[model samples]
Target chain A: MTTPPLAETILSFLKKINPHQPLPTAEQNLFELALLSSSDFITLIQLLEEESGILLDFTQIDPAALASMQGLLAAFSAAETGSKL
Target chain B: MDHYPWLSPPDHTAQALRMDHHLWHYGQLMTHAELLSRAIDWSIAGPLRLLAILGNQDPWVYPAMLAAHRLGGGFLPLHPAFPSERLQHMLHQCQTRLLLVTSDGLATLDQLLPNLSDSMLCIITEDTKGNRPLLFPQHRFLDSTDLQQLPARPAHPAPNTQAAYVMFTSGSTGRAKGVAVSFANLHAYVRYWQTHHPIGPGDRVAQPADITFDLSIHPIFVSWASGALLCPIPPATRFAPARFILEQQLTVWVSVPSVAMMMERLNILRPALFPTIRLSLFCGEPLPTRTAEAWRQSTPQGRLLNLYGPTEATVAISAFEWQAESAQQEPPGNVPIGWTFPEQQAALLQEDGSLLLSAGTGDLCLAGSQVTGGYLADPDKSAAHYFYHPDSGATLWYRTGDWVQRREDGCLLFLNRVDQQIKRHGYRIELHEIEHVLRARVGHDWVAVIPWPGGTQPVRALVACVAAEENSPTADWLQHCRQHLPSYMVPSRIMVVPQLPLNHNGKINRAALQQLVQATLFPTEAT
Candidate 1:
């Protein structure tokens, strides 16, 4: 079985958290739309780690990286590729 | 001995405080305060209070507080993170003429220049070069360099009846209400602490609260009066509170329960992590049983205390010493608020204005030395909450708005706020009770219960926002709640979030949670 893309996994998790609200596009601002809080950001990181098999240190990651869907995908991609964020 | 205990001579050498790398001795604090007081007298012509917008744990803040008191003027401490509009409102509310700002607060003041009055005076503590232009040309600017050159004067005493400080609390009316605490009230609180929980020389008290919060008053005044060292935790280290306590070897730990919740979230609360802390206190919000247990394990040698009070009450007017065995005997969510202070009287009043002596739930009313005079310059607001007690020789009682049940043992167990009580299906439900049940089941201390479809609806759903560890399923939490709570009391929806939102005061922001529930669960409804 093939794995889903990073953006797909993030969008899926966002939908699970708030099924009533419209799902955000990859470039949409999750934080600005009130779809994410500090706690929700932590949960998103955990979900991304599970889906991508990349362990990210919550303390080391900048909170700005979780502000938007694009930022979330970038953070996940950086962790997966072992590159600096 | 000076009438003001804070200005009196220390019992030992002046090593009174340590803020990170900086060490402030008693003599240095008094000398700087004297110099700052003289500068204020020279620069400002009229009677005015000095409002400080500095870091809570800044070394200059304590002296600024003393200087203001010495000049017979009140000191208002404001959080720098507050929006310029709110800051402007506070400045206007207090009629602040002189503002004491640290070099860090200069940028914030610059942004607020448009909102500040032209007659305002700015005193910058770290501006030695004196290069920064005044935010307003009419605004007078003084720097630390100028204050050091001013000749020191003898300590001028403020009247005991004078207002010591003015703190702004968010009012239910969407505006900030200024609470003016008098010197007599503070003195009474200090005397109460001295008589009950006495701190002596060599004690290191932790200052973890924001300078604007009333919780900060406990460590600041108690440490200064006892000649003990006030160790202020830096903002960067606040998240890792257990590590900060261990590194500082803080003898007395005083902070909101949120710090412990954060420590628990980060898995930092190891057994015996804070062995040096002799007195551990949690206040500003409800103390969950699990958080209390984790804290007790960390500070095995320390005495765990839960204090209760609003800003209207000076610091904390009541306290409960948590005992391990007794805590286990009580219900899972119940943490007794314990006994009122010696000078204060606590009563539970029913809806019909009759007092409930024992074994009943009602509004908790407090009357005594710890209560403030009233809200700043707003008698209407003050009259709404405070009233004269005809039975107690006309003593004013502050209606706390907190609904608490007086147990037969004379201890008070806090229920939800009277405002938070929702009537659904012809049944009145306390939202905090549902939150308590959820917290007990989820093993998480950070949980909030807000009314869903929130408005003037007679029947509303209860939405439970639980801060769970990663990968925890919401269905299991819902099942757990169903098992524990009755049909009417169980929450309609159990939402699993990573953390609960906090407002400026560090308490659970119910308004923000209600907004989140509305946006996510009821998006079609008007917020």
Candidate 2:
């Protein structure tokens, strides 16, 4: 259930948008839980790009996995590593 | 059932719907509607009873709508994601007789059950997942199995003048009001799309909008009227819909322009990526030139259209096609709303409270069959917006608040709003409505809601400014807003200021306040 810090950044950013929401579990699928919508997922990607200083390739990401915080965090770490390599 | 192709499908074998791995033909869809309609007719005795479909976006939605009309009742779509309080007001406002639930809507129905009035909430669903008993002597569940056992009963087609559906839009009075669109009104609008456009049996249309949104009306009617396939894209796939669109080989695409903005953000809008798309219909918000151009490239064989209208006018009344380029006449950047449909009449309401028939810029007004009869049961609101124009020989005209400019060539350009109403993320919102709810909670009149980076551009946030308040009740205000207003209407930020900017006439200076809010959002750009 544990994800990288980038997931923490997304959770914090989501909190800013919907202030009333409680933090979701690391294994929880934000989309199914209705905590975050698909539109919000795209917005989170833009915010993550701004914070990470990398242009992530969304074509390489698995949409189903990206629905969870841990999966999103893992994708971010992979994108960061890919950019450096 | 007369003009609708779904009644007796054009080709019973032709595919009519694609949802959740099931591809149902026109006959199959009609059977579902027939069976469901008989079940409804048996349980609820009476014609013209309103049926409210409460659920997430799903395939069963269209069938439920058909079932309602099949029994001569009206269909009302309610998004379960909205706060329970707002949904209660809508249900009570229309005196909903039956509640139709989809598989995805179970949790939402559970939350809404306790708060409902003492009267029975007649529910129709497929899967109950039963464990706890429902309220006795009041509530009842009618599942698919029950519907299958019911004997066949003929559907009573309502009169054309009767309402086909009633759509609820944001109300500045703090509760939403319903715009009752009759069968005649719906047919008048849908007939235009069917006759004028080339869409036919082979086309597969992607309805990317939620049922609650009026934009979704286009695909459901336009496709079914011509025997085309209707694909109600799931909510999870909407923002990132490239794969689904490509996989379905969708031929027609309909959605808000902001969705393309989302696709643009995700870098999914590449040229020629959606070659199968033959028609691109954009409405519910202004279409940016950049988004339109990218979409035009994506659909190499398609036509890109920009349309404009309020929910009161039955979807859209005007459209501009991208391929018909008179480069000299078109304005820069923002796409024009083009011309009103030939079947309707358009006039301008000038600044001095007079009608302008031919030229000049002013608030837009529409008249004809497409104009709604009136808001449900509220003659006062009906009087405020809908009226007969004395100069036009008593023709009923619906006042559209959009500021528009018309040229000698009959092309229309969207200027701006004539009021504080704004479109945030393709959702029509009245800023005054947000302020109205907050004023009651905060117990003050100083709070003003402003769309950040304002003036027709995409709104990033709704910022509330309170004068002379030392502490910002940001968290509490958000909690209160979540319970009262829809998410899009909720203010993302609350700023405590010394005093709100004011004009010399003692009015809140909106332009000055917009500058202040924008400055706060982007501090480095502030002077």
Best by DockQ: 2
TM-score of chain B of each: 0.78, 0.93
Query: Candidate 1 DockQ category?
Result: incorrect
Q: List residue ranges in candidate 1 displaced over 4 A.
A: A1-85, B1-4, B7-14, B42-51, B54-57, B129-135, B420-527
Q: What TM-score does prediction 2 earn? A: 0.90
Residue runs of model 2 more than 4 Å from their true location after superposition = A1-25, A28-43, A50-65, A77-85, B1-10, B41-48, B127-136, B324-329, B468-471, B524-527
The true-versus-predicted C-alpha distance at residue B112 of model 2, in Å, is 2.8
lDDT of 1 at B50: 48
Interface RMSD of 1: 8.3
Candidate 2 residue lDDT tens string, B70-174: 767678788877889888787777776577888767777777777876454445566552632444335666777767777876777778887788788787777
Candidate 2: chain B TM-score equals 0.93
For each candidate in turn, the TM-score is 0.73, 0.90
lDDT of 1 by residue, B120-214 (tens): 66777884625446436767777878777767666656676767887876554435678878888898998988888887777899987567777
